[model samples]
Structure formats: structure tokens, C-alpha cells
Target: MRQLWRFGLEQAKSCIFAVVIFSALAITQFIEISFIHRYDFILIICLLTQLLMLTSKLETWDELKVICVFHLIGLALEIYKVHMGSWSYPEEAMSKVFGVPLYSGFMYASVASYLCQAWRRMDVQLMKWPPTWTVAILSAAIYFNFFTHHYIYDFRWIFKAATILLFFQTIVYFKVNQRTYKMPVVLSFALIGFFIWIAENIATFFGAWQYPGQSETWEIVHFSKISSWLLLVIVSFLIVAMLKHIKGKDNGNYV
Candidate 1:
């Protein structure tokens, strides 16, 4: 029973930031603050919440840098995707640029924040890690495909297969109290991707963004998007991996 409780507590601690962001999305939908755009209001809440987390030492400077990088990367993708008519923000907001709101970037930053928190809190380490050059090349291709798919044949399935081929031997070790547990790195990506898809559905329901089918009425996001999330998890994972791998090397604990 005590072990179970410890497990639950660790889970909550790792996920608290994501929970807060999702709750903010859900809560913003019901708020009728007339003094500002709803998107802007959410932006204020998210920024302030992030600041609070940092000030309270819940997040480190390195983690903040990772979150910021995701924010910029996500914002760039948002601009292009919105322009491509893949999805859109229907509401007007002062913080919007090229049809993408700044707060939308925070949504992506939240994912990076979760990863950073989870990595530290759980004492995660990688085993049989692929070469950094290989990871960089694959991650770059995965990110490029997100944009190129509209204009060219989508090679996401190929990339998906590559992820398995490359990392099948890789394991991620994480701590639970004095005990340690491990899982295949690919499984970690899939699990995180699944949860992100679930969160995406909730975000859409809360009017965070809308698909064309959802322009008139809210509906569940397509399950197929889970594959996209899986690929994106790879991208996000690679970025975080570089930082963790460096630390692991410095500590002489990883290959």
C-alpha cells in the first residue's frame, strides 16, 4: 500500500504542470472576462503560472530554456499550419500573429515542461543510446515532414518505422523511491503520445483551437492524429534527449 501511494504521488508530481495547463484551458472556456480577449486572458494566466513555478524553484533554468525552445518551435509550426488551413484559432486576440496566438505556443511549451519535470523528478536515464548525430538527423527529418507532407508524399510511416528500428534496444530507466524501473524508449514515446492526443481532444473541446469539422460544433479529434502525436513525441524526445544525454555523459553513467 505504501508503494502504491508512493507511485501515485510520484505520478502526480511529474504531471502537475500538465494538469495545471489543461485545467487552465478548461477553466478559460467558462470564464467571461470582458476586459480582454479570452485567448489573451489564458496567455496571461499561463505566463503568470510559469513565472510562479520558476520563482518557487519548481523549475530550473535549463528546463525553462527547453520550454522556451519548444514554445518558439511550436509557434513557428503554428504559423505555418494556420496558414496552410490545417487548423485555426477562431477568436480574435491581441496576441495573435499570422493567425496564431502567442498562448498557443504555451500549449507546446507545457509538453516540454512536463518532460523536464518528469526527467528530474524520476531520475530518468537512457541505455544503449543511439549516436547523437543519428538522432539529430532523424529528428530534423521528422520536424521537416510535418511541413513537407502537404506539398510532398508523406513519409511519416517510414520515419515511424525508423524510430522502432533505431531505438528498439534502447531503454529508459526511471526511479521510484529506492527502486528503479525501466521501459523500452519507444513505449515511452507511445504512452506520452497517447496522453497528448487525449489532451488535444480536451483542448479542442475547450476551444483552444478548432478543426474545420469543429467550426460549427465541437466533436472528438480524429484518432488518427495519434500517429502524428507519436512522431511529434519523437521530435520532442530528441530535443530533451540531447540535454539529458549530455548530463548523463558528464556523470559517467550512460553510454
Candidate 2:
């Protein structure tokens, strides 16, 4: 029970960035400020949060680089998805480009931040990680599918299957207190995706963005979105894992 409590504490610590962002979403939802657009205000809040984390040593420079990469990747997707009418930012914001608020990218960055912080806090390691080439190809395919699905037949289920086949033998090891725990890599992806889905519900309730059905009357986000988050979480995890692998190799402590 003690280890479980410690594990929860570490997870919460790792989620500081996301928590702050969510808090901003909730606060801005009800508050009225004439000088700054809500989206821009949220963006400023995100930037300040990032700076604070960096200055406080809660996030390293290297991890920030990774977060930046995810931010760009996510922003590009947001632009395309909004264009395709997948979802939208209904509010007016000066920082919007092609109808997507710039702050939307930070939503994705928060996921990367959590993964990096949790990896460090829990002393995470991987076992039987797949080859670099295979992982890279899969990651590219998963990302590509996100865009192509709007035009072509969706291959998400196929990619999910591929992910399972590729990582079925792999395990994730994380420490809590004095003991280490192991989980199937695929299961971890599903669990993280589930939690993100819950967060999405909260964000939508707070008016972060609106799905087509949510524009008029807010309802529970479709459960199918969980599969999408699962795939996205897989990509995020693989990128972070590869970075860790490369760093481990450099330090002669390959994970």
C-alpha cells in the first residue's frame, strides 16, 4: 500500500505540466478578461509553465527539446485536422493559424512532458525493445495514417495490430519505492490512452475545443476516440523510448 501511494505521488508529480494546463483551461472557461484572448492567455500560461519547470530543474533541456518536437508535430496535425473538419477551436483568438489556436500544440506537448518526467521519476527501463528500424517505420506509418485517413481508407486498426505484434514481447519496468514493477508495453499504452481519454472529456467540458456534436450540446466524447489516443500515445512513447535508448548507449548503460 505504501508503494502504491508512492507510485501515485510520482505519477502526479510527473503530470504537473498537464495539471497546470488543465487548470488554466478550467480557470479561463469561467473568467472574463478583455485585454487577452482566452486562447492566447492559455498559451502564455503554458509558456510560463514551461519556463518555470525549466528554471526549477523539474524538466531538463534535453526533455524540453523532445517536448518541442512533439509540439510541432501536434500543431501540424491540428492544422490539418481542423481543415478537414475533424474538430475546431470555436473561440476567437489572435494566435490562431488556419483556425487552430497555437496553444493547441501545447496540449500534445503536455503528454510528452508527462512521459519524460514519469520516466525519470520512476526510473523506467525497457526490456526486449524492438529494433530501431522497425520502430521508426512503425512510428512513421502511425503518424502518416493520422493525415491520410481523412482521404484514404483508415488503417488505424491495422497499425494497432502491428503495434501489438511488434511489442508483444517487450516489457516496461518502473520502480516504486524499493521495489520494481513490470507491465506489458502494449497494456501501458492502453492505460495511458484511457487516462488521456478521461482528460479529453474534462477538457471538452471546460470548452477546450469542440467536436461536431459538442458545438451545440456537450456530450460524452465517443469511446472510439480512445483508439485514436492509444495510437498517439504509442507514437509518443516510442519517440521517448528511442531517445532514451540513444542516450543510454552514449552513457554505456543501454536500457
Candidate 2 Cα misplacement greater than 4 A, ranges: none
Candidate 1 residues 1-255, lDDT tens each?
A: 876788678767766667777787788788787898988888888889889899999999989999999999999999999999999999999999999989998888988988888888888888888999999999999999999999999999999999999999999998888789899999999999999999899889988899989998999999999999999889999899987788777988663
Question: TM-score winner among the candidates?
Answer: 2
- TM-scores of the candidates in the order shown: 0.96, 0.99
User: What's model 1's lDDT at 235?
Assistant: 95
Residue 163 CA displacement from its true place in model 1, Å: 0.4
Deviation in angstroms for 144 in model 1?
A: 0.8
Give candidate 2's whole-model lDDT. 0.96
Per-model CA lDDT versus the true structure: 0.89, 0.96
TM-score of 1: 0.96
